[model samples]
Target chain A: MASALINVPAKAKRGDIIEIKTLMSHIMESGYRHKASGEAVPRDIITSFTCHFNGAEIFRADLFPAIAANPFFSFFTTATESGKFEFEWIGDKGFSETASASISVE
Target chain B: MRFLGAIATALLVVGAVGAAEIPLAERRSGYSFMKPDTKTMQDDDTANPGMLWVLNGETLWNRKTSAADKACADCHGNARASMKGVAARYPAFDKATGRPIDLEQRINSCRTNHQQATPLPFESRELLSLTAFVARQSQGAPIETGADPQLAPFVAKGRELYMQRQGQLNLGCANCHDDNWDKRLAGAAITQGHPTGYPLYRLEWQSLGSLQRRLRACITGIRAQAHDYGAPELVELELYLMSRARGMAMEAPAVRP
Candidate 1:
């Protein structure tokens, strides 16, 4: 969950626009290997990620095994009231992460 | 139980014998060019910060810490004599803890139990200096951590962890570093999972870091869950790495890209 914050200047004065940025870091395993006893290691990878702001759906993305580890993404959202932003990541083996940050509207 | 006891006894004897051996300079075979060059980044902009740490360690060796008012020199005398060959056997099995203990842990233990000083944080200059000082004595000596029966399981665990697939990408460490050592990812050449030279000054990190720190970086780089510093899993993995480089010499505070 290594992440950084960047302040973006808003071009649109009011409504909806997409904010796009990428995160770097996602272990995208193709799941191809032999175990200690010489058995094949199984496949697993992050499949999806989504973001919401102040309980409103804003953006979403799907990932594949080919995506490099520490998956990065860019997205957009309709400007409503500036508030809290939430991000979620869903992956194989039922792994999931949800992170949130606050945004202010001027 | 007898076999285990015998192995433990042998390990103790080896430790005792190692205490008497002269620490040699590390040998550089295939990767001689990786040695610190003038172009290598200086430590904290100081001239050869690693060397400075070693010098500070010498001072620390003689100066008594307030905790117990006992200096490393109090018991060991000249480090060139008493502490030789010690670093070459580290990442060794600690019978008391029942786990593989690296040189850093051993030093802290001595500081706490013997010298009565508070253990320095992982990357502190004091710890690093003392570590470099000790490792310098073993520069060219062959690493000789004897096999302990108790360490086998952990080594196996570490091996499994190394090859296991994890993270969003589901890539295991071995996939890139081992199997693909000769392969190119992005623009970098993937090197073998070697821990021969560690506590390295890295260009990417722009600072000195331990091998475990590097391991954590790799874990993060792969988008896998990185274990906490001093975690059992990381210790086990470190033991496995040390085993892989069984005969390699210790090259602490080395430079790396």
Candidate 2:
């Protein structure tokens, strides 16, 4: 199991490009690393992250082995209406975590 | 006899006054050396990654365990009130142990003695989280430290160690922190080594770490054999750093590069 934290404006104006920040606790192990005993550690990374605004996809990203562990993302998305924003992160070993934040727009 | 007593009284007052004069500005908070963005990251709780540890600590504070079934909150009540400025005063003298105890040792002492719980391992997440959480309570408070007569020997040793060169490099903490502060080393500006912000979030580590961990890094940087966690020498060094940092505001759980 994994945990996540999301930051978004509690209130915003319509059509405002609000900043969204997120952090997830994951190893994001690049599968290329070797253990002390000369064994290759299997890769485990968050392969995908998607943000949904009111059930509609606003942004999505396909992560790679290069992404650092405990991936943090800060992006901007226009506020269309007062609604909930959902975040989902999927990774190797069937690791999936989700979080949500809501914004009130005038 | 009355004349002798008056002379002793006069000497006592002078000594007390001399001891009370705090030399501020001899040290600077790590925040001043940080990039503007880094400082902003530390200033804003939402953006600070260190807050994650604080959040966990809050949860842990209220959660009960053991046969006695005690939580820190059960005894301390609200941490915000009870723990305020507590971190700023440590590594203070611990009368029970008749020794100096840093924040980490204090936390462990509480766990084993009061909570009846197993002590968390050094550098463990739970310990770091708890220490960070407690230290955060003292944010913005000025740090004040002095060596009590009982604790003077440790402080003296710490000061001696701070100036003593070690390793192949033969460099001491004072060489850089005191003599060459405000200069750049390896492209990073050097500030007077201050311990105010500890159990802090470091972007380089991408995790929270304690002051001892940072001190060990410095020791290793000089190619010296590093001390094990919770070593007495490290505690002494911490005490010295705190005393050097007297009157400076604490910014624990601070963000740094």
Candidate 3:
């Protein structure tokens, strides 16, 4: 697991368009290699990513092996209310991450 | 005649002193973490899966992909001739893009633009093989990069990044690979940082990985915020690493532990 950066607009007007960006560092092994002991390096990758606002799903995506080691994603949403935005990444090997940021609607 | 002889003797003495002050050639080989690691995995018996890509790359070099096109052989003639001394010059500063492009990027560009083929996805076998094939062309030529004006700033940034402390450990790349290269870390021998041989088959990785990938691993090992692939910061770091290996022979597709 590598570090990640999540950025969202500091503030947004009611019904205004808001943007969010995220980047994560991961080896994203394609299950194509072996271990130091000459055994196979099992394939492990972040299979899914999702974002929620105020406990409601806002965006989601599926990832493929072709994606680079460190993945970056950006998306836009309409702001209708103020609350918290939660981000999660699910991967093989039972790897999971959750990050959150507070949002305020003007 | 006496005055002329006296002047010649003085000049000879000065030249002798200057020569004496200069260190021996062996000491001028630049910085290196050349200490032998008893645990270093250097043989194929370790059996990294990445070696598969090199084999695949060899096939791709000879396999003709298009009707209008011939294999790499059609254009380059022979790997020994057309490819020789090429890898040593890469991660080159492309005047058109005004940025340093690594060998992987360059090979993809050539395939898309010239070979009339779709570019391979990053980290794919096709991309790895193509890169390995091209890199093998310059097996012995010394690395010679950073002469381009556009590359100077990138190299500078890379050097700065390499030395800057980061993460919870508060360690910089230089701390382990430079200052304490001869020391042990968690019972592992700290090797010198060198990019002369890359896309190397690492026993630890059990695969072949690019230098940038290795850089990302190092950052993660220290719990730092690693930059994404193709990120400006990573590119700059790559530039710095390559520059440090300037004049060293290219050893791409080299096997390592």
DockQ for candidate 2, C-alpha atoms: 0.30
User: Candidate 3 residues A1-106, lDDT tens each?
Assistant: 2446667877889999887877664668888778889998888889999999998999999998767554567799998988999999999889898888888898
Cand. 2 TM to true fold: 0.88
Candidate 1, residues B138-242: lDDT per residue as tens digits? 766777754667788888888788877677555666665555454444555566666765665565554456778988988987668899878888888888877
B1-257, model 2: which lDDT tens digit per residue?
Answer: 57645533443343333222123644568788888998988887767878888888888888896866999999999999999999998888888888888999999999888988898998888899889889999998988766367768988899888877787656677766776666666567767888888999888887889999999999997668988888889999999989888788888889888
Candidates 1 onward: DockQ, in order: 0.01, 0.30, 0.01
Q: Candidate 3's residue-wise lDDT over B1-257, tens digit each?
A: 57645533443343333211112232122113333341222222122233345556767887777544757667777676887887787778876688888888887677766788777776676777778777767777888877677788888988889877787555677666555445454555566676776777665664567878889999987778888877778878888877776777776666555
DockQ: which is higher, 1 or 2?
Answer: 2
Span of 10 residues, lowest total lDDT, candidate 2 chain B:
B14-23
**TM-scores for all predictions:** 0.58, 0.88, 0.58
Off by over 4 Å in 2: B1-23, B147-149
Q: Which candidate, 2 or 3, would have the higher TM-score against the true structure?
A: 2
Candidate 1 deviant stretches above 4 angstroms: A1-106, B1-49
Which one is best on TM-score?
A: 2
Chain A TM-score values for every predicted structure, listed in order: 0.70, 0.95, 0.88
